[model samples]
Target: MELRHIRYFLAVAREGNFTRAAARIGIGQPPLSQQIRDLENEIGTALFHRVPHGAELTEAGMAFLEVVAQFPDLAERAIRAAQRAGRGEVGSIRVGFTASAAFSPSVPRVFRDFRRSYPGVEMTLEEANSAQLVAGLRDERLDAVFLRQDTIAGDGIRLHVISSEPMVLVLPSGHPAAQREKVALSELRDEALILTPRAVGPTHYDKVVTACRDAGFEPQMGQIAPQLGSVINFVAAELGFSLVPKPMTQLQAKGVAYREIEGEVPIAQLSLAYRSNDISIALRNFVSRTLVAHRQPRIDE
Candidate 1:
């Protein structure tokens, strides 16, 4: 009739004695006998034969045992599933990233570590610019994102800055500035600077512009690239110089050389963005692992 009834029946069937079954299952002998009688009444069939020494199973009881024996295992499996899900170990998480953030070593490292640790969790990844990723997070289409945005906050979106690295210069291999190991932002005044659209990553775009102005120059604008990678490719084509995060130098795009800025420069930041109200266990686990892996402090407040 109930799980307790099943458990008592199993205990009596296994022990084969009323008193022993009662002791095994932590109930009184009289109470155990009455429980078995009640179970048989519910099923409208006698489940045990009361013998002189103990009790034996009837034909119906044997059949019932065969079916209910599996309940314990099944119940255990169900409990395990619930526990795993509660701990964020066995659900799906949709994650997004910016084009440049993907190039960061920390991004892949965090993903690898999370996958290894929570193999039961399903992960889906998307690549987009910072704005689109933020939109995805806000719209609940994405559980988390790695983006190069430091100013986006509020409106139920939270930001956790993972790492910040100095911005570098990417120049055509044949460009005059490429000859120097490091170039100052002010020196690129006359050279047209290739860039992605300001909307693609306003923080990064503004950082470059502000850094150049701080260096006493209004950077000349050249052909615009649609994305971060295209900005590097255009630099390879000698369209113009591009300023990018130092980590992006790992792209190793041919015909382009990466150089550090000599004087004051803006640092590009990579942040993990998520819905402030998201209660997904998998997403929480992912955010925790990411912050730990990057040794970043929690900035979600």
Candidate 2:
């Protein structure tokens, strides 16, 4: 009826003598014998044939013993699995990211470290804009995400800043300003600028606009792109110029050239965002170690 009953029955059946079985199980002979009697009564079948010296199994007893013999192995395996899960070595995690994050080394490096450390855990990656990633975190659809700090607003999430890099002006390689090491924001005042879609993250779009305004003039807004990769592609084709995170230089765009912006505005911050309630040990270690290993060194311009 219970695990103990199964264990007791197996022990008595194996030893074939009530006194010996009780001794092996570290219990008194009378109690062990009474327990066997109770078990038989519950099953409505006699499990042993009484004899003067010892006992022999009934047909039903032999059948039950064969099935119960497999229990020890099954129980051991179940306990091992539970232990691994508790230690965060075996589980599934869903991660979301912006398109630009893929271009950076932080995401890939962290994932590689996580896989090596916890080979039993499975990771799923989803690509979305910062706004969508934030929504996914709130709805419990994503375990964590790498996104721009400006876009994060809600208080229910915790953020760990991984790196910060200055915004670069991306221009066509053949453009006149491309030859320069740095470009002033005022130089692009009259030039058409490709803008990231407002739906991508309102806060991020506003920051860009504010930066341009602080430069003494409003930008000539051109076409809006859905994601960073597309915006970079457009810049490569000389469709328009755009300001992007400096790490984006890692992504080689054939006709695109990047330059540091000449101003005192704060650089973009990249952070790992997750729900405050999430307590995944694997996720915590992955985020922390990856940032430490591949973080960008500070550069003074």
Candidate 3:
């Protein structure tokens, strides 16, 4: 019969008396008795034995009561699932990030906060070069990506600058430039530079190259690393010099010296891009939380 009938039956079965059961259900005893009869008639069996003192369950009623007892918890769980899905708290979001973005305080902090706030949301992280991160976003394999790219080339993409910081140099600790707290970009003109390929992070690459050009020298490129973190390893190995986001200095790239560039501060950026038309609630929640958590004034509103 109806859920109310099952509930009414269960209450009567528990209380063992129609008057008390009706009192618990806030219904008149006569109506409750009639409804119980109606349920029995519908189910084709009696569910209670009418006794002088109170009602005892029939064999069928005992079986039915056992099943009805489980409904409350089941119904509660179903309702909770609906509420969680409505609130975008139950689902999976695949996120991509550049190695450099992983080191940025904002990125990791946002992830930690998101996990803590929405424990029901399944978070999968893909760490790759910026180019690969963008590709994952384009292929729809990822819901969002954090990267540094000179140009985002797809109409289907919506990109936002999540974090920004100045680029700092990573040199061998024994290098002559390590003697200075700050070194001019021009002073490193003759140094062999270790940099991630332009394809790996064109925006960051372009910024570094443009800063060098502004200082009046074409960079003497040396080793090419596939990932940003690897650039530091190259520096540690004394392969060449590298310029990375200031946040990257947090990494323990032993034997490497971190320094600020003199005169002007060149900017390094971490951006997030997702499908422009994606209407998933989970993705929207993540983006909004990130912007708010990092105190980055919401740009897209």
Candidate 4:
């Protein structure tokens, strides 16, 4: 009936004597005997044969023992499962990243650290533009996201800035500016500028535009690339020059060279985004782990 009944039954069956079982279970002998009798009545089966010196298993007792003997082990496993879930040690997390954020070493490092620390968690990764990644978070399709943005709008969305890097110029390998160790932004006033559209990443797009205007020129807009990687590809094809985060240099596409700006530089920021009210254990653990890996402060702190 009750769990106490199961314990009493197992103890008496193990000791093979009511007095000894009572001592083992730290209960009075009379109460133990009464509980055992109650159990037998409920099951309509005597579990032990009374003997002069000690109790022995009845035919029915043997059958019951086989079934209830597994309870202790099963109960232990169930408790462990519940504990792991409560600690956020098991479950799956869906993480989305913008194309540029994926190029940063910090993104992969966070994932690797999380996997090493919580091996039981399953991780799913998706790459998309900042707009789509934010949508995924709002739609509850993604638990968290890594993206490049200075600001995010709308309710129920939270952002944590991970790191910021200066933007660099992506130029054709044979271009004159590519040969220089540092290029001035004012010098490129007449060159066509390839850029990611504002709709894809407003913060990054605006930063580039403001930087150009501050340098005393309105940039000549040329071909537009939908993604950061495509910006490098366009530069490789000599379609136009573009500005990208310094980490983009790692792309190492042939026929493309990276040059630093000589004066005040535009910055690209990488941030983690999620629902403001998300209560998922996996998502909480992931956000904490990422902030720890990057040495960024947690939103709560």
Model 4 TM-score, 2 decimals? 0.96
What is the alpha-carbon lDDT of model 1 when measured against the actual structure? 0.89
> Among all windows of ten consecutive residues in candidate 2, which has the lowest summed lDDT?
292-301
Candidate 3 regions with alpha-carbon error over 4 angstroms: 51-53, 297-301
Taking all chains together, the TM-score of candidate 2 against the true structure is 0.84
Best by TM-score: 4
User: lDDT tens string, model 4, 1-301?
Assistant: 9878988899989999999999999999999999999999999989999899778999899999999998977888999998999888899999999878887998998999899988999999999999999889888999899998867997899898889899999999999988998999988899999998999888888999999999999999999998989999999999989899888888999999999999999999999999989887878889988898789776558
Model 3 C-alpha lDDT per residue in residues 1-301, reported as the tens digit of each score: 7888988999899999999999999999999999999999999999999999889999999999877898877889999999998888989999998888888878888899999988999999999888788788888899998887545985898887866788998899999989999998888898888888887788888888888889899998999988877889999999888788998899986798999989887898878888888887788889888878767666357
Q: Which tens-of-lDDT digit does each residue in 1-301 have in candidate 1?
A: 7889999999999999999999998989999999999999999999999999999999999999999998987988999999999998898999999889998998999888899999999999999988888889878899999988886856888888889988999999998888999898788899998888888788888988888889998989899888899999999998889899988988988899999999787899999988888888888889988997888754342
Q: What is the C-alpha RMSD of each candidate to the true structure, in Å?
A: 1.8, 4.8, 2.5, 1.4
TM-score (C-alpha, index-matched) for candidate 3? 0.88
Tens digit of per-residue lDDT, candidate 2, span 168-269: 888889988888898888888888788788777565577778888899888888878888888888888778888777778887878999888876654777
Total backbone collisions, model 3? 1
Return the lDDT, model 3, position 193.
Answer: 84
TM-scores, one per candidate: 0.94, 0.84, 0.88, 0.96
The lDDT for every candidate, in the order shown, is 0.89, 0.80, 0.87, 0.90
Error of 1 at 96 (Å): 0.8
User: Which of the two candidates, 1 or 3, achieves a greater lDDT against the reference?
Assistant: 1
Model 2 whole-model lDDT (C-alpha atoms): 0.80
